[model samples]
Target: MTTNAELAARFEEFADLLEADDVEYKPRAYRRAAENILAHPVPIAEAVESGDEDAIDDIEGVGDAISSKIVEYVETGKIEELEELRAELPVDIADLTRVEGVGPKTVGVLYRELGIETLDDLEAAAEAGEIQEVKGFGAKTEQNILENIDFARTVGQRHLVGEARPLADDVLAYLEGIAGVERCEVAGSIRRWRETIGDVDVLAATDEPDAVVDDFLAWDSIDDEIESGPAKASVRVGEMRVDLRLVVPGEFGSALQYFTGSKGHNVRLRNYAIDRGMKLNEYGAFDVSELEADPDADPQHVGGGQRVGERVAGETEESMYDALGLPWIPPEIREDRGEIDAAEAGALPDLVTEADVRGDLHTHTEWSDGNNSIEEMVAAAENRGYEYYGVADHAQGPGVVGGMGLSEAEILDQVDEIRAIDDEYDVHVFAGIEANVDAEGAIGLSDEVVDALDLIVASPHSALDQDAETAGERLIRAIENPAIDVLGHPSGRLLNEREGLAIDAGALGEAAAANDTALEVNANPRRLDLWGSAVQAAIDEEAKIAIDTDAHRPATLEFVRWGVHTARRGWAEPNDVVNTWELPDLESFLH
Candidate 1:
């Protein structure tokens, strides 16, 4: 079956091919349509096939031309126009473009100039020194291509956490409905809320392994069965892989601990256990101090062996940690980066969670590119039990989509609507704007416009290819502006799409701390900029953090969960994040 993602991917290809040909305006239109198609709540392919006109029309940004192509694709499993574009270009647009500093136009240039159609071709050209000889190409550019080509070639094709987590939820829901499944939870990088994950690892506790495996294989979402066994199964779900492991309820906790690992953390933890003369593994914690050395056997039951020594704990994760005289570590902090030491010292941070997020400071409405009205968004915040809410739609600035950002007059008008909404809704609404910071570190808004906003989130939208020192200076300048309350998505990154900038987090953090500006941890899964390591650096410098969803609509407000976990990954506590403050305190901070 053709999924929404598959349909969206087709449109993305159309956009890329169009851009490669230097067809200016249509490419952006197609890309916008592609985003809408990806975000649309229904199956577009099914709508085209079933002749559901209303469903097709309901998709935003899809003009008649795009819709006709969709119809053609649904009917014939191919778009004739796209095929023609592909044939004309005759290049691996996606893979070639994945190389850092390579774009669709560059792909066109490379193809027309040097006949570079594949990774191998590009590598051969670069190696033969043919690339630098081309007009507008330099030795440095060639070197960078050489540097990034390997990553683009060898980088694991990981699924976005935002996409994978929901699929895991669906799998969990299905497993919960089974006859004998006791408990089920996701493990691995997804469990730790990493930006991208290799696969969805699900652990289910069940005495009836064969029955559970049979039902898992029977799951409707499975696109292909990779492998199946009595206690475990691996299945292909769309582009992602799902691995299911069934264990007896007693071993569930230990198994989860072992599998939900950063690898380094588990290694350090095993060492800790060894130093204590205890053994820790997927099986359980055992007192091995009294046991004689068995040279032929595995000392660590990491691969599932039962009762290696006098078993001390295994039934619960808490018990597993308690057996080591340490508290259970949150998965986000399980990178072996002093978390175990912190645990042993009883100094582990009270990390921020989704519930700790009282409101989102960065969001949008119909006044900008967002789909909903200000009232609808406020109502959604009220539903979430927020003490206060903020709507900082995109302000007129560099990098904003044309006709999508608000002018000075429009910004003031929206503030009025937001004030009224604040009175009507239970949640106090703050009028805000996400102003654009240009390459030279100047804000787009005037003084009057900045004063009108209750909060100002200045973010870089253009010229993100600055050097580390230059990017840091630009960000520091943005934060130093008294009107700017938060620096949103500090790096302007779109995970797997682009590496936005090379930034000196420590320098930016120090400047932000001195300026009293909060560094935002953007929660949109794609732009979880100021990721764990960067956020940690900023927090270490005593900079305040703002965890925001950057939501476009009400339903997207829940994206804060991703942000919260990301903040947790940086060792953020409730007090470190402004939104977790009391309403009055947050107001004071923003002002």
Candidate 2:
């Protein structure tokens, strides 16, 4: 079994090795193939295993040579060309590249200059002051490497939900196609849409457990089989480990409940069951107090008791909870964090959903760092049937020195272009700027520039390492700005890269509430910035929230769901999100 992720990594390495060796066109081809493979809906290995050369070649950006290599890897778990390239470069490309400013070129240069192959070697060279001695490497570059290496080391191996979700969907699609498979679904933290996931868990209901297990083991994307049994199998695919379990149709509901757990939630649920003299386990909910069972027996064994009492529920999760006299709880809030109590009181908040979002308030176009032009981005929004779309390109400021942000003149010119586009489309196009908030919480742009825009998303770009109190005060000052409508990616954290800022979230939320500024949940997977807990704190203070994608491209606008769900995790309802409101209503609120 060879997963798309593993194959893509090999191709990426091939590209890196080629670049280090200065092999031109082939490297681009390899990189393109790798990107396409990762984004492919199904596992690349599956097409290869199907012996369908046409299907393999049909993958976007994949040519005959790459397809052949993919087939070779799937069949033999190795690619000779990649192996040769690895032997030639023999550098820790991935680890080195994780450092903030390091890239393949840097890696090649450092390796050629000082034989640096690992982070330890890089760190030692930097500490010894030897790296600055190399041509093209300066003292500052060396210092940055030293400073960021520790942050890189702390970066975990967990995959973001954005990355893991498609893989899970692919697995589910594959399982559903198997004969005798009655139902299949992904479980665990994935179901709850946790920002990062350790691995993927899937459950299926079928009488043919053996057949299901065999089919799963033979999945085209499997890199290696970890373990396989009659009812369960775990396999490694790409960079993710996928575990599958099979249960009888009658027990499917109970199994889903047991497996889709935040352990704390299940523990509390078991306690609730006991209080009602009911036994709840993977098999089903049963009235077991009347039956004789040893109190001193192991808990695992206790759950294995005979189905002696009434079979209250087993076929559905709702029924399982209904039998316990509790409403079915949504998985996202099942962390035993007052969800049970809320369910008891019939007070669960109606979570905001993707459908509730009427617009995206923070996006970019060619005017800034985004790839698409203004017309393209607005067209994309109109296609999504949005009532409004905010074009908030980066404003020239502290962290935007690289010509990535618009000058005042450029911003003014773009406003005219946006107004022109707005006249043509059904969607109300908002001309806005994502202005930088400096150390003292002053917006980077002038009053005239801010006044010209329909919206403003002020964000902290530099000086992200401030102490908690300073950070909180800084954000509060930004929120207090009358021109600012939203605070974007408040923490400025990238998932596993930088820690961003440490702030008192409650205080920040309170200040935002007072100032009528909405706090944003930046939905870009890398920065789900005002994460769930922070969102909760903000909601507690009745602060308005805006679930914006911070999208730079049209395809990425769909990322709104990530922000919407993150808001839900924070206990936000539709009314809490300004983007969920009608256009006239939202405009009034913004003013």
Candidate 3:
């Protein structure tokens, strides 16, 4: 299958080739094809297997030539032209392209001129002042290359969600506060809540592009300025480069549509537009004929164009969708994941909202590894206007052998302690234990101890070293226990650290649904376990989800924002989320 990452990488490589070769128009075509393929809802290989070359042809920006390339790649697992291009410039295209201010042309030039095959070699050459000896390469360019090499190495390969997410939030908040900004969104892979990020891309709708660009360039946190233009600006915020683009209100939807993509999604949408005799661009959708309007026409800041097949019509994202005969796709589901089919069938799920979360079902306290006191945790939940808060501290038995988990006696004591603190807040607080699931699929907490707690969360804390089938069976049995209310952080993943337990989430989700147990989409950026895909699977089985912060501190409780984003990414809706249910309704589900 032409995965989103594979397609995006190919298209970007093509773009770099175009720049290196200084090929005009053709690069955009390839990029557009890449974008559409990235956003395509179904697997491209499936579409290819169906012998529907029109599937490739339908993407906007993909003319017959690009379509033929796609067909060729799918048919033979190789693209002839791309292969030839690779043969001509056989260096690691992506690695070389990663250098700051360096593109394909520079890579080719350096590779050909100095035999610079590696970053080490490039650095050595720069230090020896050999790079400046090459045409078009100046001292400044050499210095920039050296500076970027360290940045590239330090950034490693991937930016953790925990680290990149805050930076994104800071940028989004700054953008939102700016004047003339109507709607703002963080686009690209970041928006998809992908595990890692390379660069951050933001798109905003503003009436004044000039003012918006000025404000963006002046952002206080920005360490360096890259480029600022009418439609787009790039800046280096710390080590991460942030790109911001402005679009008018009319073009907001289309621009958002174009920018908030997996690239494949955009290509697919573009194709859809083409099939409908319309043209889709970053600005908006236009009748294919309207795009032919004076090639020398001045680029305006307006949103969309008016005119559909010679008859003048409206221009707007809503109208664009109407023109295309489909509905607007939510940005989260824009990864080309069955969204088009949902749009065609009008079967998109009513996604869950923050308001639906009436209570927080999983949280920690100072008694365990949590940094916050029980009172503080409850108070924070009350501050958020939650009706109830479940305090599921770690139980000291089973797999929680060495951690801050409480002993069975300690748990019984905490229940009474929790009851004692209950009168201090208006919100009801339930005492629970996050019991470990042993290798045999039995919870560490005794039945008597489990029965005493208001909420019980079963999770795998030890034997994470188990195989997929063992781990899956272990969780299934644990989840099947009527005493368990929610399955916590199913995968146990730690950002950039642990990979957690391996299991078939589909089977676990079915077991959870059968047992009427909710699955936890751990809100911690590091572990967003029961990730979007897993959550989607759970939802498909008619199982409910609990979007919990799994907070260790009061501040960490705010990790709920990321958790909510996780659920949203999974296409979870109010009804599908257990926390969204009212306290009484939720309590009823407790066995």
Model 3, TM vs. native: 0.67
**Model-by-model lDDT, in order?**
0.84, 0.84, 0.74
**Model 2 over residues 521-582: C-alpha lDDT tens digits?**
99987788888878988989989999998876676787886788788878889999999999
Local accuracy of candidate 3 as per-residue lDDT tens digits, 187-293: 78887777668888888888899988998877756657898888789987645778898877766766666666778777777677666656666656666544443
| Root-mean-square deviation per candidate | 3.5, 4.4, 19.8
Q: Give lDDT for model 1.
A: 0.84
Off by over 4 Å in 2: 1-90, 97-115, 120-154, 291-310
TM-scores for all predictions: 0.88, 0.84, 0.67
Superposed Cα deviation of residue 288, candidate 3 (Å): 3.2
Choose the strongest candidate by TM-score.
1
Sorted by TM-score (best first), the order is 1, 2, 3
Candidate 2, run of 10 with poorest lDDT: 298-307
Q: What residue pairs clash in candidate 2, if any at all? A: 1-222
lDDT of model 2 at residue 411?
A: 94
